[model samples]
Target: MTAPTAPPPRSDAAVGTPPPTARPSLLRRVWTSYAFRRICQSVFVVWLVATITFLLMHLMPGDPIEIMAGRLNSSGMSHDQAMATAANIISYDPNANVWVQYLEFMRGLVTFDLGNSLTNPSKTVFEHVMEYLPWTLFAVGAGVVLAVVIGLSVGMAMAYRRGSWFDHVMTSIGSFLTGVPNYILIAAVIVVGYTMLGVLPFLDMRGRITAGVEPGFNFVFFGDAVFHAILPIIAFAFTATGSFMLNMKAATTEVLTEDYVTVAQARGLKAGRISRSYVGRNAMLPIIPQIALQLGTLVGGSIVIEQILQYPGAGQMLMAAISNRDYPVVQAAVIILATSVVIASLIVDLFLVRVDPRIKSEGQDA
Candidate 1:
C-alpha cells in the first residue's frame, strides 16, 4: 500500500498529456455551414460575371476615349478640344496601366461607388441607376407574383381534374403560352392593339407616369404609373404563368400518387382537408423554389420588354447605356441584375426551411 501511494497522483502536465481541445466557436460553425457555403457560391458567381463584363467591355473594338472624343468632335468641338474634354469625361485613364484601372473599378464596385456617366457627366451612375431601378422591380415583381398565385391554383385544379376537358384545354394553353416568347407577345400587342385596332391607348401608356400626374404617395400618381406599366407586366405574366402551371401540375400529380395520400383518403379525411394538409403543401415545395428562380430571371429579362413599352425602368436605362457606350452604366446594370437573381435564390433557401416540415424536423433532430 505504501509503495503504491509512493507514486504521487500524477498531474496531466507531469504525465506529458495534451490539453483538452476547445469547441468550435459559433461564428466558425456558421461559416462552415452548408447554407453559408451556398451564399458564398452565389456571391462568387456574381463577382465572376462582373469581372467578365469588365474585360469584355475593355476588349471591345473601339477605344472608349477615342469614341468619346469623336462624339464631342461631331458635336462641333475641335480635335484638340474634344480630346481634352473626352479625357476629362471618361473614367478610363490612358496614362495609367490596365491593371490599375481594373483595380480601381473593383474598388469602386466593393465600395458601392459606381463612377459618373461617360455620356452625361453631371450625375453619378448610382444615382441614375437608382432613379430607374424601382420601376422595373415594381412591374416585374408584380407580374411574377400574379403569375405564381394564379398558376398554383390552376395547376392544382388540373391535377385534381386530370383527363377532363378543362384539363386538356388548360394543358394546351399552357404549352402554347410557354412556347411563345415574351418579347414577341409584346410586339404582337403593339402591332395588333396599337397599329391595327387602335384600342390600347398606346401613346398614353408610353412613360412611367403621365406628365400632369405629380409623383407622390397619392392614388393618381401611383395609378398612372401602374397604367403605363400594364403592358410590360402582362407580357411577363403570360410568359411566366405557363411554365409555372405546367411545373405545378406535374408536382401535384406526382404527390397525389404517393402512399400517404392513399392513407389519408382511406382514413375518411375530407377532400378539402387532405388536399390542403397534404397534397397542396407537398406540391408547393417544388414550386416555391421555381417561383424564386423565375422571379429573378424575369427581372433580368425585362430589358427588351421595357424598351418596347417605353417604361422608363432599369431596362430603358441599360438600353440607353449600351447605345451610348456608357461603360460604367452598363457595368452597374449588369451587377444589379445579376445580384437580384442570386439574392432571390438565397432568400428562397431560407424560406424553404420554414415552409418544408421535413427540413425543419431534420434540423431539430440534428
Candidate 2:
C-alpha cells in the first residue's frame, strides 16, 4: 500500500504567520501604570484635604465678618461703620449662598490666585505667605537634616551594641524624648536655658533675626539669622531626633538578623564592610522614605514651636490668620501645606522606585 500518502507539505505561509499577538487593552494598560495610579491618588488626596479644610473653616462657630467687625471696632470705628467696612474690605457677601462662595474659592484655587487678606487688603495672601516661607524653610529644613544625621548615627551605634549600656541609655533617652510634646520641649528650653542658667546670652529667644540686623545677603545678616535660629533648631532637632533614632534602631535591629547578615558574618567578611554593605545599607531603606516624608512636612512649620519662639514663619502667619479670621490667608496656608505634603509623597514614591527597582516590580504586580 503506497506508504500512507505523506500529508502534503504544509505551506510555509501557514506556519510563518503566527497568531496575532493580543494587544493590551487601553484600560488595562492605564491601570497597570505606576505613575498613573500615583498621580490619581495624589489628586484625590489634595482634593480631599482642600474640601475638608474648606468645610471645617466654613462651619466653625465664629463668623469671619463678625471677627473682622470686632477688629475694625478696636481700630476706633462705630459698630455700624465697622460692619459696613468689614463688608467692603471682604467684598464677600456673608449673605451669599455658600455654594456660590465655594465655587468662587475653587475658581481662585484653579488660577493659583489666592485672594487678598481681609485683615490686610493691600497685600495679597500670597505675599504674606512668601514673606514667612523662607524663615520656616530655613529653620525646619536645618532641624530635619540635623535630626536625620544624629538619629542615623546614634541608631546604628545602638544597633551595633545591642543590650549594651550604651544602647539601653540611648533607647531610654529616645523613648522619653519622643513622648514629650514639642511645645513642652520649647518651654523647657526657654525656662532652663534662658530663665534658670542664663547661659545662652547670644540666643535670640524671639523672632527670626535680631532687631538691628539688615535683611541682606551678608555675613552679618546670615550669622545673626543662624544665631537666632539656634535655639528653635535645637528644640526641633532634639524632639524630632528621638523618633528618627528609635525608628532606625528598630529597622537596624531587624536587618541585623536577616539571612544575608548571617551569611556575611559566616563568610568572614570584615565587620565594617558587612555592617556597611549588608546591614546599614539595607536598614536605611525604611528610613529613607520616612526622611522624605518628614522633609515634606517641614513645609508646614511646627505651629507650637513657631508660636512659642515667635519666629516669623508660616505657622506664625497661620496662627495670626486664624485669630483674625482671615479666610483667604487661612485657606491659602492650608492649601500650600497640604499641597506640599501631597507633592512630597508623590516624589518620594517615584524616588523609592528608582532607589529599589523591586518596588516598581511590586507596583506592577499589584
Candidate 3:
C-alpha cells in the first residue's frame, strides 16, 4: 500500500499548521483600532455637548435677536434698521420653527461656520474664539507646567521623608490647597492683598495687559501679558499642584515597595541616582495620565477664573457671550471647552500606549 504514501509527505508549509483565521472586515478593523475609537468617541462627545448647549441656550429666557436689536437701537440706528440688522447679525428668525433653527445650527456646525456673534457682529464666532482662546491656553498651559514641576519635586521630597514632620506639614498644606476651590483662593488673595494690605494694584491687574503695551514678541508686551495672566495662572496651578503632590507621594510610596526598586537599591546605587532613575521614574508613570485630565479640567474651569481675574481669555469671552445671550458664541465656547477635554484625553490615551509597550501589546490582543 506504499504506506499510504505518508499523506503526500505533508508539505512543510502545511505541516502542523492551523486553519487560517478569517481576516476582520475593514469596518471591524477600524472599530477595533484604539486610536480610531478614541477619535470617534471624542467627536461624538463634542457633538453631544454642542447639541445640549444649543438646546439650553434656546430654552433660556432671552431672545438673542431682541437683545441684539435693543443694543443696535441704543446705537441710534432706526428701530426698523436695528431689528433688520440684529436679525442679520444673529441669523435667526423669531418666526422660524425650532426644528428649522436646529437644522440651521447643525449645518453651520458641519460647515465649521459658527455664525456672527450678537455682541460683535463684525467678527464671526470663530474670530472671537481665536482672539481670546490663546490667552487662556497660555495661562492654563504655563500653570500646568509649573504645577507639575512643583508637585513632582515636593511630592518626591515628601515620599523620601514619609512619616516625618516635613511630610506631615506638606501633606497638610496639600490637602488644604486641594480642598479649596481655585476661585476661592483667588478671592482670598484679592481680599488680602488688594482689600486689606492695599499693596496689589487691583485696577491695573484686571485686564489682559497694560493698556499701552504694544502687542509683539518683545519683552514689554510679553512681561505685561504674563503680569495680567499671573493671577489666573496661580488660580489654575494651586489646586492642581496640591492634587499632584498628594498623588505623587502616594505613587512614590507604593513604588518604594516594588522589587525592582529594591534591586536597584541593593546594587549600591547612589540615593539620588536610584530615586531618579528607578523609583521616581516608575512613580511618575501614573501621574502622566492625570496631567492630561488636569489640563482638560483647567480649560473647562477657566471661565470662572478668567471672569474673576478680568483676563480676556476664552473663559471671559464665554461669560460675556452668555450674558449677552449670544447663542452662536456661547455654543462655540461650550463646544470648544468640551472638545478640548475630549481631545486631550484622546491624546494622552494614545501617548500612554507609546510610553508603555505592554499597553499596546495587550490592546492588540484584545
**Winning candidate number (TM-score):** 3
Worst 10 residues of 2 by lDDT: 292-301
Q: Write the per-residue lDDT of candidate 3 for residues 33-124, one digit (tens) a residue.
A: 87787788888988899889988988889687788788889988988999888788667665678888889898999999988876778898
Candidate 2 regions with alpha-carbon error over 4 angstroms: 1-31, 74-76, 266-268, 292-301
Q: Score residue 149 of candidate 1 by CA lDDT.
A: 88
TM-score of each: 0.88, 0.88, 0.89
Best by lDDT: 3
Model 3 lDDT on a 0 to 1 scale: 0.87
Model 2: per-residue Cα lDDT over 148-258, one tens digit each: 999999999999899999999999999987888767877887888778988866345568778878999899999988987886687677766988899989999999989
Point out the worst 10-residue segment of candidate 3 by lDDT: 1-10
Name the better of 2 and 3 by TM-score.
Answer: 3
* Candidate order, lDDT descending: 3, 1, 2
Best of the two (1, 3) by TM-score: 3
Q: Give the range of the ten consecutive residues with the poorest summed lDDT in model 1.
A: 356-365
